[model samples]
Target chain A: MKNALQTVLALLGEDYDSILQAWLETQKAEGVRRPDLFSDRESRRQLGDILRGLGEGISRSDLSEGIALDADSWTDLRATLDEVTQERVERGVSPSEMATFILAMKQPVFARLRERLAADPTRLIEEITQFSRVVDALAMHTNEHFIEARDQVIERQRAEMMELSTPVVQLWDRVLTIPLIGTLDSMRAQEVMENLLNAIVEHSAEVVIVDITGVRVVDTQVAQHLLRTAAAVRLMGAEAIISGISPKIAQTMVELGVDVGEVTTRPTIRAALAHAFRRVGFSIEKVENARG
Target chain B: MADTASVYLVEHVLLVAIPDNITDTEIMSLQEELSTRIVSDGARGVVIDIAALEIVDTFVGRVLAQLSSMARLLAAETFVVGMRPAVAMTLVELGMDLHGSRTALTLSHALRALRSEGLA
Candidate 1:
């Protein structure tokens, strides 16, 4: 096993360029190349770097003990693939497409080993299995990194969207308004409370109108989050008026037994604003005008 | 433990700023001191400013609620002021209601709310 692996490593070190060229040909023939999504030059460079790094990692690796690539010994290989995965994820490349690209190198490397080790069938089988395992391990590592990078991208966008969605506005001298949209989770609830409280202090707001017309459902968890926000607002000495409770939501709230004690609820933002104005000692009267 | 919370009179209202590093014993003594000051000085309102505090465990929460109820017995309104949003959320999550005690965003707002309602 050791001698067969040494022979394969020797071949890779000696004829690295030819195997890499064969792999590129296989990749192109397999239609893994997508020029429409990005420039082919950049993708080719990433693949080339990853192959070179993988070759170096395998040559120095001790495959006699096990086929798994030790993370510390394969730092360069991991770094190269990490860059490729990050770029591919940013370009919206599907995981299957990435898998296909990484898997295409297997056939070319296998063919090279066959040509060199076909004299000994048993050794050929052992070396081929070891080489295949190494390739498989690298592919799996790249795939895992691809998914992690994609998740990080999504997590970042979610955070940015949360900040964009929760905007605290001041409707009057002592009134603050937060028009909620989409689902309300615990983290978002915390964000809402923080933003509202900061706005209250910033504006010295006495009344806060939390409009939930954009919210589609009010489940028990969502109700609890809303109630917590209201309680936090009250702790700040500002009245929290939950507005725009559709009939559907009101029914859901009752079914859920979500009691919003002392937190005023209104049917619409307009009504809530009026109530807030009244609470802050303001009243709006209709104006009568004559044409001049 | 090093320094206790001090209750002072500001505009005929008791101003109790609970320091962040106060010990449990200090908290009790501070509550007693507030009671004594509220009665002897004839304070119309009591504002407990806790904005600098990061956590209000169940014990501290109960003390604040007790202080409010106790102030009512002395004919003085209790307004907990400057509660951080995070602290308020945690208190709710911990199932502590502060028992219907009045809360304000700042010292000034606490004073204004009490004055507007004729409690201060």
Candidate 2:
């Protein structure tokens, strides 16, 4: 019981350079090393950072805490893993590929430990178990962080998409338009209503044309969201005019008994704008003598 | 948050100031009490001041709309005023329409609208 973790630390500390070299070679042998994706200097730097953090972590950790390393004592190790995983996830590297980088380190370190502990089989088993557990923990930790980072990336992208889909345009001095371009899910519907209402208040808009031309279909839920948006506008003392109702959508609306409720509907944005202009008391007229 | 309906009769108008948190039972009783007050007192208009309310869910929204409709049936106009922007947004997302109810930005505006509509 010579403290397997401390022994591994000594082994790693004494020949850190060679262990990194062996680790890099093992990565290349496993066909996971992509020099094109990561330069030799970058890979070497990451390995150096990992080895340094591992050494520092092992020194601070209490091995009697069993195979599980104390999470608080491994802050640097966690940081390194987070950084590596975040970059890899952003770069479109697969989880397995990211895990491979950490797991590949095991071969070199194990080979070194086996050679050094060849004289004693019981100590060898203990040391191998201790070393493999550390590697597995690090690999598993990296995978977990990678998944979290990927989910964060996805969530951010979804928010960005919601904002992009619900663009509020100022069509006139006191008239704004929101042209929804996708399926109106509850989340997107909320986003649409908030953006449209804020715009209405900001402009003191008298008329708002909600153009759903780009929207795919009008289900009961979608109709409800539209009605809600219009109702909010009316509540704000502004008239909400829905435009771009296709014949099919209109039929669907009638069938579903969906009521737009005192809000005017137009077949197109142009017609809605005309109606908006009329509602705001700005009638368009054709001037004479441009036909020469 | 007050359980009893805090209704004030101001110049032939039922002035109802809704609190921040009201239960369904309270809302129902409020509706009953206001309708009775409107009829018995000969109130010509109602101005619902929802400024104290931060959030209005579907039930509250439906209740507000229904209250206005009830007032209309009694020949009294209803003006719902002081709706916070956030509350309005929540109401819209919940698909609550204050049907045939006039909305004003402020209590003064509500009174003015009722006056202009010839209800007061």
Candidate 3:
């Protein structure tokens, strides 16, 4: 009976029911025998051969049974079986045994079937699971790549802006001269104010000379920013001196009604320094050093 | 608008020549362009030529002060030139600080001022 069952299983391709029944019968025959052989790779391999011998019809039946497994149960079973197969592989199991172990692992077997069908792909239930996994992995990889690239670009921009904003030299003991060249917007204005305030605190400057001969025109918002900056400087116990006023900017200021009365204006940094020096009780005079 | 206007670059002075009837947009654009140029070229100072200005209002005065501060950040000096008597008086009447911030009477005076102050 055991031989017959083995022959039938080999011919039928180890359909789950046949394999389960044969193992049960073998246990009955052996009286106090353990059922551990059912899970053994060699035993599974022999059973697989028996089922395969049962021809194409038996193989179809096995396939149908696999499809009949509940989706959730099938997933759990596949995960457990794959873990076991991985453990076996790590233990250096023989290739043949590994193959049988992998075959018993539903995930790998399903993956192979999916690959075969994907070449001529269909919307079958099994194919859906495989496709979803591939999509999920691709999405995760893409999101990670995008975030990394975005962060790198932001870091680079921040560094560049900082370099552009750094002040290089101080012109006087109580007066610090900063040359501004570029369009002044709200963000840049804020940066300028912050930098100036910090410098004023650091140097204890009484006057801040701002030369803007490079500026072509002044808008209302920009005018407001400057007023705010001047106010901020005053609050910090320092004076803000504005040096450059283009005719175009002057006209705009008049039209816009922006007032800058509290701040001092100079035509150039030289004048601004002179004014600052005089304000601090120092005058520029020609120095003559004679040692001839 | 005139394609070209007289430009006088006094030694050590920034001369910004503007077109007649300078509009708000033009003023804003000029400020942005000049600021960028100052920072890029590391200009020491500038003198703005406002000889063509017929009206000096509050907004325009405010803008002038703003531009001066911006130029200062770039290590360049700013000077307002060609302030007409009427405009100056109007500015003063409006309580505007045209003289309080960086401003000049003429392009040459601005240059001389820059030179004298050692910021030329």
In candidate 2, the residue pairs with backbone N, CA or C atoms under 3 Å apart (3 or more residues apart, or in different chains) clash, namely none
Which lDDT tens digits does candidate 3 get at residues B10-120? 443455876558777678777877776675555678777766777867777777778888878777877776655445445544656543346543565567668888977
Q: Model 2: per-residue lDDT, tens digit, A88-142? A: 7887888888889899998888888788889987877887787788888999999
Model 3 chain B poorest ten-residue lDDT run: B1-10
Ranking of all predicted structures according to DockQ, beginning with the best and ending with the worst: 1, 2, 3
Worst 10 residues of 2 chain A by lDDT: A61-70
lDDT of 3 by residue, A1-292 (tens): 2221222224234345544445434433543122343354544553344223223322223332223222442343333333434344344444444333323323333444454455544433444453334323323333343445446657888878765754624777777866777777777776677777667657767678877776655788878767766655653445778877766777778899988776788767778888889765677777699456
Best candidate, TM-score: 1
Of candidates 3 and 2, the better by DockQ: 2
Q: Can you rank all candidates by TM-score, best first?
A: 1, 2, 3
DockQ of each: 0.57, 0.34, 0.02
- Model 3 — TM-score against the truth? 0.36
Residue B80 lDDT, candidate 1, scale 0-100: 91
Residue pair clashes in candidate 1:
A236-B104, A236-B105, A237-B104
Worst 10 residues of 3 chain A by lDDT: A1-10
Better of 1 and 3 by DockQ: 1
